[model samples]
Target: MFSIKSLHKIIFAISFTALFVVWQWYFVKSVFNFDFLARPILADGFCKDCNVILISLDNLRAKSLLCYGYEKNTAPNLCSFAGKSYLFKNVYTPSSKTQDSHFSIFTGLYPISHGMTVPFTSVLDSNIKTLPQILASNGYTTLFSGPKNDPHLPLDRGFERGFSYKDKGDEPRYWMDNMKKNNLLNRKFFAFLHTYRVHEPYIPQKENINKFYPGGPLIYVTRNDLCKKAYIKLLSQYPDRFKNLKVLNDDYCNIYRDYNTKYAATWNVEIESYLARLDPYWDAFNNLDFLVKKEYTHALYATSIYEMDLELKKFFNELENNKLLDKTIVVITADHGEEFFEHGGHSHAANLYNESIQVPLIIYIPKSKSQIVEKLASSVDIMPTILSILGIEAPEKITGIDLFSSKENKFVLAQHVTANLETIITLKWKLILNGDEKELFDLTSDPEEQIDLSIKNTNISNDLENKLNNYLFRLPKYNSIKSEPFPTWIDEEQRKKLIETGYF
Candidate 1:
């Protein structure tokens, strides 16, 4: 009755229609029942006397940790802790930047809601209720200890409220010293420790460097500080060679401005003219990528992770020796994850990819058995989760749900305000909307986000977009007064110092 080609075409059309209908039905059912799919409460609440110890490791990714299936012993101590703590398998940061992610964690609000997204300009509003302020009001002394020299993290930004001791260092000795000197261990306290050692310029000790890169090239054997020095000298000598090289401006010094002041002064040429005359040829300077892409880079990053783990191990041992571990809740997480050529770029604040937003969240509460929480969670959930664990009611303004609740939400939202990117990720799908461009990934099939199914799966894409918009609509307008912007702009003098430190 019909030609063979026509019959085949008819069959294909019917099959496609059936698949589309089935997919739409499945998507709707999953979105509605996602939270209930695996709704198991992992941990119990803590007593009122329990103290809190929060640790933030910068640029640490969930996949980098051995507990998360990394083959390397990058974080042995963390792995041990993970076995004894509630390891959140699907936790993400609200934003992929350091300052903005921390703001979301402390304030229990999204970046836009808190009015702190940019590092140089965004400041935490004083009117916003922060975790430390609330804990201090409830008779818990707050303490902050991290690098004292970073200009980006000043105490005036409302994060330092109720902080009795704010010191600097990546090591735990200084913090322990202060705790003993201030009689903090005897009191109910909330200590927040941030470490940048695991961040860029991965300057692990020589032992760690050698351990990771044994018998490797000396160029790769050097720590980040040394590598930075060499890279800086090389760039400084041939400033014209790297004029068009793509770089994160915040991570590096303004070399063009520096060269103009010093070299142009000697050459008697205008800075603008000198910069304009430099021919753009990044391909010729292929060594730049080579240096960063070498095995040494991976080794250095791994070594840093190991070194951070050792520090935490020592800190935890000290706490355990003092019997503090039995009475305190320890929360270890990161602001964001680093990327190594993932999605064609490195470091963070570039995309909403899993490599950039997914962070390790390990929470150890006293007298609680460890279990992995597979539900979707974000940085904003930390504040509310901590409050709930302490048996305190979260503020009405808090948008995050209790991660321990069986009724945890179906989806988690992550954003990058700088790139104008927003994402809505469920257990099965991730949809990223960047202006007019859209990318959809099926996490079950493509966890690497290598494929874009937006065009092929238009129904799923539209559904996720609608969900994202609905969630965004619930956010109250941010009305907090913004703080004065701090000066992080580089000048001629600042440029020289930044270069020596291997910045940029």
Candidate 2:
């Protein structure tokens, strides 16, 4: 009993619905390759079927790892795995921070090129091609696991879009559970695991509490308690300098909030006084002597690494049990290194010293020759190397080179936005330039970067400065939106968190 016009309208609606479904299915099939979704692809441009796993350790200095010549057994499991891996001894990251360094890793571009040099409110361009994006296009199921509360890392950026299964924590069980739920055992897969255990306010499990701090002067109380006491005392002295400051509790430490007034000299003065009070506790390591309470902090840092190593061992054992280790390519590296008053700085993202920029790069490929490569490498190289190994051609505009390529990288760059800093590292020399200040170190003689050779070696300083300037100019500028300006201000939640964790 419907009218002729109404019947025609219903027919049109049904036709439109059918067309939409067909288009959607076609899109999915083209993008995901539903026909051959389960097939695995080898890294040698063949179809032998292999899996790729990228594990990023946060705030882990190469000097702290036993594999990297540290006296401590912080990364024993990693050391054991390095026996069958290709270890790159001189690997550096593009940025001395987590957000930008990881971006440089996922994208084969430096921090300046990607326009994500700063964190909190920074957004990745939708058009940018990420590692997961490339892998997903090639019939690989992409997964991600990182810090639960770091919004700058996951959803705000486009990284989460390329991942099919992503968890909020760095623990391997979360990734394993997701993989199992998706039935990804036999399917091609790429997993990115990010762990921040070795980062600031280092608090480890109860069992590992006394492992490094046994009978130490500050072993009776938590490092966070002492740090908070100092910070509260400073706050009481200079309340005006700490305006808009708030406090947040991380899992390991009590983070003092950040503020716009953090740049004021008065605030720094009070903080310096507090640091002076705590210097004795930080001078436990005499080799790398600096005036800061590093013993308590470093002990906790080592314990965290030990805990993470235990989890890593467990993950490796699980893979072995499942017989998946033989077919998987495992990459282990860090976003950036930590500092223990190495250059009068306690944490990272403020300086570009070796202790802040140098990281450990261990690549383990199944049935491959294990050799230690001393060639210069950067975080940017990770993307190209991954793509090259996976039988995929890198993007045309990629700046990073393949790690296994015959050609050697002559120089690598690292940047930090706090001081508008730029650093250039060559085989023999390293130049760190901040505004009008320049510091040149002869790496061959001064590995610790303790000697400043800028005044004595003007020729070397000028040459490196020119190279850094030219390199930066070659990269793209920050241009997120044409209509709206780039967002430099961070939100309150992220700002507070960053400040608490010494990001500011």
Each model's total of backbone clashes: 1, 3
- Model 2: per-residue Cα lDDT at residue 35: 38
How many Å off is the CA of 446 in candidate 2?
Answer: 0.7
Weakest 10 consecutive residues, lDDT, candidate 2?
251-260
Provide the overall lDDT of each model, using Cα atoms, as 2-decimal numbers: 0.73, 0.74
User: In lDDT terms, how accurate is model 1?
Assistant: 0.73
Q: Tens digit of lDDT per residue, candidate 2, span 255-328? A: 34243234432223423433523443333344443432566667778888898888888888888888877888
All candidates' TM-scores? 0.76, 0.75
